[model samples]
Target: MATADPYGPVHTEGNAVPPLDPDLAGALDDLAGIHPGIDLIRDGIRHLALDRHTPDTTQTLLATLAGSSGADAITAIGHLIARLANADHNPALRGLPLDTQKQAQRHGEQAAFHLNDPTLHQPASEASAAITGT
Candidate 1:
């Protein structure tokens, strides 16, 4: 069973508040598996990356997507971050520290956090065994 936050819906702390319409939530969630050819993850809290989003913002986005279907919310969230990290102009996402980048590369379904930056990155799940010491 998934645990819901007492906050229920309206978000404020991280990024600007997200739209709370159930229909919008459902649509965004459906995008999870569509393979957004362009990655959506980024390091900052605005512009075209996921990093531009706050943890609460990300959570809100994921929760909305999770409500849509059988998709795994975690992975959906990860994909969004991956999209952002791979973006071309996100300063916060420029070359990352080797160790930190490695861990982000390891998240099979979840996001990897930059300990120093607190920004989320897409896990390098499939590219390298170096991440797993394999």
Candidate 2:
């Protein structure tokens, strides 16, 4: 007979959550190692998710991530940087007021600059390559 215990039902191996994508996980690890203020960035992500006050830099990066269609983390990040660098030239913002568009473009350029710092890019690229098996 099965015994009833005070604890809740036990989960078997079959019921466990699937493992994370290895490449994505590795890329995140690499980013953490290279980024100077990873903890702050994480906090910023959280704040943005929770609708709290987040810096424009954080918002721009997060928005890029949200809209990116790259096959891997590295490509996605690179694409985001590129997009931010050309923010003012994007056709999608044509409907917005010129001043508002300019402000957003400035924020995007600043975000790209910070993310493209050599200190972070080198390690992140190496990590991305490892994930892509290149």
Candidate 3:
């Protein structure tokens, strides 16, 4: 079976990372279309100011998730949390400065409120009660 590259290219030619598989790139592009925060993740990576070349880190994240084992909804929620909530800690965005991390988190938190649905996320009080089984 042809497994996807769990991680993208091992080496790059002077910051020129290899092109992603067309299908994978397409899928990532589709995600960007629907999820505005996905691009925020992309922009956050670009803003990292690293000397080395960076590939599409958001796409890299999704591609990596493609190889992991998990329920679809769980994986997706986790992906959002990583990209939006814990942007700095995620593999692609790890080691970023504190301000940047906070910025990403703020955007994420705002997204949660703006996109909130009772069915999707319970109120904070209810969540706390559920967790403590109170």
Total colliding residue pairs, candidate 2: 0
> Residue-wise lDDT of candidate 2 within 27-74, one digit each (tens)?
555667455666565555444444433344443443344322233343
Q: Where does candidate 2 stray beyond 4 Å?
A: 1-18, 21-88, 125-134
Write one digit per residue (lDDT tens) for candidate 1, span 1-100. Answer: 9889887755556636444457744555555555544224211112323235554554545434332222444445555565555424345655787666
lDDT of 3: 0.50
Candidate 3's residue-wise lDDT over 11-81, tens digit each? 66754544556775565566675567778754444343232333344333333333222422334555565
Give per-model TM-scores. Answer: 0.23, 0.34, 0.27
For each candidate in the order shown, give its overall lDDT on alpha carbons. Answer: 0.42, 0.53, 0.50
Alpha-carbon deviation at 122 in model 1, angstroms: 24
> Which residue pairs in model 3 clash with each other?
none
lDDT measured at residue 27 in model 2 versus the true structure, 0 to 100: 51
| Residue 30 local lDDT, model 2 | 60
